[model samples]
Target: MESSKIVKALSTVMDPNTGQDLITANMVLHLKVDAPNVSFTLQLPKLDADYKQQLNFACQEAILEVYPEANVHVHMQNPAATAAAGQGSGGPKTNNPLPHVRNIIAVASGKGGVGKSTVAVNLALALQELGGTVGLLDADVYGPSAPTMLGLQGQKPKVERVYGKPKIKPLFAYGMPVMSTGFVVEPEQAVVLRGPRLAGIIRQFFEETIWPPLDYLVVDLPPGTGDVQLTLVQTVPVTGAVLVTTPQEVALADAVKAMNMFFLDSVNVPVLGVVENMSYFTPAELPDNKYYLFGKGGGKTLAKKSQSMLLGEIPLVQSIREGGDEGKPAFVNKEDQVTREAWMKVAKNVARQVAIRNELLPETRRVEMK
Candidate 1:
């Protein structure tokens, strides 16, 4: 069988979203031809499981029509891997496009006002506190709260000449690199943006920023499984994702969607675990009391239902709130050992999950069909 025949057949298969053939969109990747056996990979824009299966089947059918005797091996390749394969620089190459960074972790939520940003801020700090060099990217375009939480609001990314190219210098807070849309625009000003514009900004974060060598880069994604979430997963080589939700029925419902996005076959971004933020409330005056403000065990239930680790249950504490507002993440301050430990436990669980993912799965693809 000839690879040219397979390419021509792929060219006939149109993308439902773009109204263009897969070959035209450069989706057909790594095509190989062998007598009685043919193998190829598809790099899709979005990873809808049903759609991928259909596309794979259609491609196989098309190829078989021309080469009836050939056996086909079709694989879905990640965009990150495809991009990494193209770079011809003499520098050390990595499967991840972001070679300077060791690991990229995304923090996501199903809905807003679930303390997602709060969890993201504290978690980044928590990771850094655990002796890892970390960078935090606030991917929440509509609600870029990481700057305020990280105490880097109103700060701007500086441009420097690196290797004869202009590179964005990430702002540092509490000894860790930080970037956010808040840095680009005024805090109170509403960003009137659409999907493409939002995606462009996210792309800029990875490509433009001259990030130093680091252990981890924690991305704070906007709430919901919208453009920002898709853009982050598709563009960056994310190691894993952390789903944040409150112990409430409504929040858990949305959290389910967010978690499943990472679990999708095309994306396959391993959910490091689920974090139950504001799991319970502990009054400052009465430290011994526990209040189920948003109901109980929702995080644990969600984790169990999702078959993911319950990273940690963070309580609704006044100090945690105060610390975020004051540009001091509670985890960074060891004064309140209880709150510090709570956040620290989550951080450790995240690290453990990342380590497990690297050891077992290694690459982005977590599971495969037999």
Candidate 2:
């Protein structure tokens, strides 16, 4: 009978593709209760032009089970319009509006399951540890895993008025603010987004989310150099990118594609460097022994071939994965030398590259057009 309990329960209902629940997906909006007379609105993103009726029926069925006698309503809207409406006034109405964020660094991978999101989460946390205001944007629309990785699966962004306009207040973890598309949809709903729709969602992540003054905003892009990646590169003035790869030939090939995507004429974001994740596995008993589980130096070789720096090599450790799953990033584990040192190396190298890029690059206003 407790409204909070019901809300909490509903938040656990995750969308299958994104691994994020409906409440965090922003699907369940405007919940109200007058004693037992409860009321709420469910906003479902229109995934297909022909599935309006199907979506409506699905929403109705989903709501009735939880709120038996409660009044419920479902609405369908274009994803672009929905995203635009979320961004408040005084914010940039243009395609790219996050002007305050000094550096936009995309943490990308050529393929999935190479610990891309893990690299992104730790890198952002490591940057925050270095005393800068950091924000993490989970732009992996297909599989928005930041919510679970950051331990914010059940949290909802609070709404606030900025200049009389509604703004989405990003959720925080260990002082870093974060926003994810996973924060907006149900698990069962398909994320069947086309190129234009994907672009609109990324645009909304910048415009709608109320990101405070930040020195760096690390974007955790979806794996692959696909439509979503292309859209973000074209739309956001990405200052640089950090390519992540496992020590494997297949992963290295894909990582190369990811790097080349940035070099494309349409998407000219600078390639900051490369990070080699799970570079080696070290057992606690024999700390000195290095086991190349995925093959050694693939990332280093790739970086050398591309004429980019090999930022750092992170060892495979159980705690790194555990920490990510538990919402406490391994970078914060100062007591654990392996985890701490590994992340610190990666963080320092990334920071140094960012500094060098800022100093050597032309002023934002004076940079020559392609």
Candidate 3:
């Protein structure tokens, strides 16, 4: 019995979680064939007894159909643990809510009305354009812009049962998975939640959402630091933050405060870079002229203070505001080459910064409660 034939047979076995074959999902590993004895390790997202038993039985039958008299031994293990072991991160840490995501980028602002959500929606799309599987989490319960910006307003994500456990299926927008409170709650209703209740909703988004494996999960945070920000740092190992601020002195102070929260000893998430939104205004007719309506160099000043790079400057273009209100994002507009390139540059800088952070710094740990 050749190993290729055994692999081919296993490929026919589907993973109910993702509706992909075991081989295609890269769940099967360590195929060791010794005559009539055939054994392999199966990577699983969940290790429920019934689910495991069902998969084990299916694997045996599939192999048996191909090569009769073959004794199949299937060992099941969590892929999350295997991934950590391979990366040399030994021992158990705080339970990570997003183990499948390589990086969690917090696109934050010091205050509102600075185009933070715009930066986030476009940044996620830009990352996808650069060949990375990305997802978006609009963590701003008070004002969830993903629904409108991604043209998914009034649409709710489906809750499906996986392995007898309920999971929230993320809504897709421009080929990226997205989760936002705007999906489930009315604009006015979202503001009624208090303290723990708010945290619980945020926790649900992190733990219950059935997000596909992604290279980056860009989280669009509410302006300023509060329950949502704290919940995020404590929930997952945030790779870094991208602070968005307008090119003005007033916004700089608020941006610094937000950046300082991440810099706290307890929460040591690195500042990837700073994005200056509305850095200048350029009318459609006067494309080459840059009007510094919001002042100059606030992004650079913030970056200098944070000891991070000035990722890029996004001009106050009419199309950006129009796109946001019209349920369409500027990043998806193919004809807008200038806006497209700007977002792509920010995404490229973010990706490079993430690579540098991962190389020079140790993996971030959850902010433990004292």
Candidate 4:
């Protein structure tokens, strides 16, 4: 007699195509109940007769178990067809690209611990400060740092029904929308996720998240070229990549391997520029002194090799490190004028490089899986 119970019962039925339950998949819509009489529409991925009949029978049998005398009326609809007919907002099944986002900037590195996530988070915030609407996606499945760095740890993105289909709503941090695997699983759980699972999560983040129109979407990629990087280029058209490295030869060596992935003939994503993180050390007490702790000129060297410019050199400062650990990036601390200027400079140069890339070339194509 209650609708909640009816919804719960319907949730038990599964959608074979997606490997999810009906309710979890957001397939059931417009359910009306009058005790013994239940009617609802089911949005399907395909409209094949056998597929439709199978789903319809499953729904009726599920409801019958709860109310033996119930009459169930099942209606079927296809989003792709409806959208093509001008009756829907391109239904959930349409393979529509992110036309609303002007650019997708990927922050990457050849190895870990190069401050790639720090640069990505600060760069995204700095871009927002410069009057551009931006979002962040932490695509590092194994070591998602956004949840901790963004001060959004232990929070989960909410799923809501949009156009009768379920869509994930990103968590907002520091006035920007953000998505990351850290939101769904703990660091311990992420260690076991392999190639296909990682790709599925990355793909879902793009296809299911209801991201608003954005001027730029900053994606923090996993270190080096692997499944996450390959899946990224395949899922969405990356605007460009900002390679991150330190002033060390080993880091630069590995970074070139990552850079070459974008340069490959089949996957030709443009290199935006280079960001040299941890270039030097400047103690808070001695603000005037700069000491080279990790060697020098690695950023510039990589820039020359990649045919791109050095975006900026980020010095190692206590405040910058503490801010990252505490979920308040240095770019927001007005007292750290030097660090703020460094990030803002990177952001500005990135914006300019993206503009130039878009102006001079065609939109980068999504790498097709062979």
Candidate 5:
């Protein structure tokens, strides 16, 4: 029943990367005990798909051996894996000195085409409307959709000098500053870059882009827990992460994996909560009728099981998808409709959760990079 005993048992689990026990690798964080239940998060070095799967199975086995009755939760963190996190100073550099940007949150999904980018775009606009300066970073190097979603397609970022260093100024859209790889490269060209080169490009996007002072910088991450995700976590001092998923078995399953990635020992990024998108489909004609296009409550169930908040559930609206395809998100429209209302609710929930998180953890002063 003692958590210390559980910790000691975990010490036997070795990290293949370091060839040392997880305890010796400093992979365990936030270990807690409550009677018969034991909970802790495991952090791991940036791991490839094969190693990640192997580690996950090994952790489960270790937990069962320690406490067969205890509920075990394993979270994986990939340190210095993505381009954004990898490009930062190798050592413990102080946080970036950007007072205008209060917090940077990444919107991530384990699978693509789940409307993650759409949610991110609307959420950023919604945050701005809630009386905060916002910046949107399209870190989806493979398919940077912010440009199209925000109706800024084919627009190039203006160049400016910041402290004698050249920087690319973000394009403005509805009072929000937006930057994306889409603006820098041809759509067809980006799809061809290899993994390492893609990481370099993402790093360059952060370094070369000129992001002004803002209240929130929401990054739309590339789908999956791969090199790109790892790179961003390492380079940027992300305040937290938001997992987006549809209320379907497949999406929810992958979403849990994405959440586990953040809980990993090396990743250690706080998860704000899970946002359920396309929870139900409602035809415009039948505003009152809600159709369960996908399985119901998958997201809410996942949130409950993980003990994380259910930020909000957005219905499947044709207008929402049409708006994104047309390069104008529904949230930006002033008309009061069901779709707009849904987005507004999601936005408010995100802001409220972020405010609470900020208050609880008090923003870490920007670390200085020497």
Candidate 6:
């Protein structure tokens, strides 16, 4: 019933990494209590798959002894990566550039051809459908597909003067705002700039644009762990990330790498969960049939192995593919109940995971790396 009793229980569980009780090291954060229910976030300074699982069990056991009827929710968070020498001056300070935005989620895949962009686009639409104000940022600068995916091909965001300075207005589609490199260059143009130049472009998106306040901003990142991904993570205060992958060994390998990046000491971005896109196939005619075309359970395995949540498993649907090519994401089509429901499931899971993270952890922002 009292928060202190829960804190006292948590203090009994030793963190394997530090060999100290979580309370002693300031690992417990955002603690709250109600009769027969307790919730708090545990910010582990370091984490691995095995140790994290052990810590969760130990903490739960410790708490249940104090309140046998407790409904315990322990949200795990990784600490902010230490700033490198000459990267920024002083200790880590919150560098939240877009205070108006409630949450910024990066959707990434281990590699290309895994439907990461498709997932990103539909997920944004579905989030909007759930009565939340959402925005989409096509951070894949080299191949900005959000413009086409959102039915905004050949469109450009308008620039307007605001307070004696020029500001770009994000284009709206389905009442949700969007911005992307596709709006600036021709459809076939290649973004051949180096890291520094890419970082500059991303910086402008955060500091210069006049984006409306939003509950969630879904950023579709380019596949693979590259400079663009690093630029966005280092330059922006990403709330969290959702990983996309197929249910195959090869794709799972890369998804592991992508997931690992978020856990890196230099990155330290909390991964909301893993979404297993193209998990399987089911024929349109035979509604009751199922097929393991890409093998099965890769997403669940990855999530379990990484100690992250397996948000949802999306089956391979033809209309889902057709919708993207036709400049209409499947989630927006109300007539296609099957496709819409599949994506809506993922969207709901994503929203739930993000909500837990936001409630438990401090807002993440770009800190100067001195």
* lDDT leader: 3
Better of 1 and 4 by TM-score: 4
Clashing pairs in 2: 14-187, 15-186, 15-187, 16-187, 24-183, 25-183, 25-184, 25-185, 26-184
**Displacement of the residue 311 alpha carbon in candidate 2, Å:** 0.7
TM-score of 3: 0.85
TM-score per candidate, in order? Answer: 0.73, 0.71, 0.85, 0.75, 0.71, 0.74
What are the per-residue Cα lDDT tens digits for candidate 4 across 38-126?
Answer: 99999875677866877888889888898889989999997666766775554233333454577999999999999999999999999
Q: lDDT tens digits, residues 148-263, model 2?
A: 88888867888765333456778888888899877777645679988888878887677667676678999999999887777676566778889999999999999898888777
lDDT of each prediction vs. the true structure? 0.81, 0.75, 0.88, 0.88, 0.75, 0.81
**Candidate 6 overall Cα lDDT vs. reference?**
0.81
Model 6 earns a TM-score of 0.74
Model 2 per-residue lDDT at 207 = 64
Badly placed stretches (over 4 Å) of model 6 are 1-92, 367-370
Worst 10 residues of 4 by lDDT: 90-99
Candidate 3 C-alpha lDDT tens digits along 216-265: 99999999999999989887889999999998899999999999999999
RMSD value for candidate 5 = 18.5
lDDT of 5 by residue, 1-370 (tens): 7766777787876554323566766678888777566667766544457556766677667777877887766666644344336676553333232323578888999899788999899999888888888889998988899888888888898876432345666788888888898988876683777778877876666555656556789999999898777777656667888889888889888888888988776767778878889888888788999988988888787677556688888888778887888988988666637777777777787788788878887444322222
Give a tens-digit lDDT track for model 1, residues 59-159: 88888889888899988866654565577453222333354467899999899999888888888888888999998998899988878887887778888
Sort by TM-score, top down from the best: 3, 4, 6, 1, 2, 5
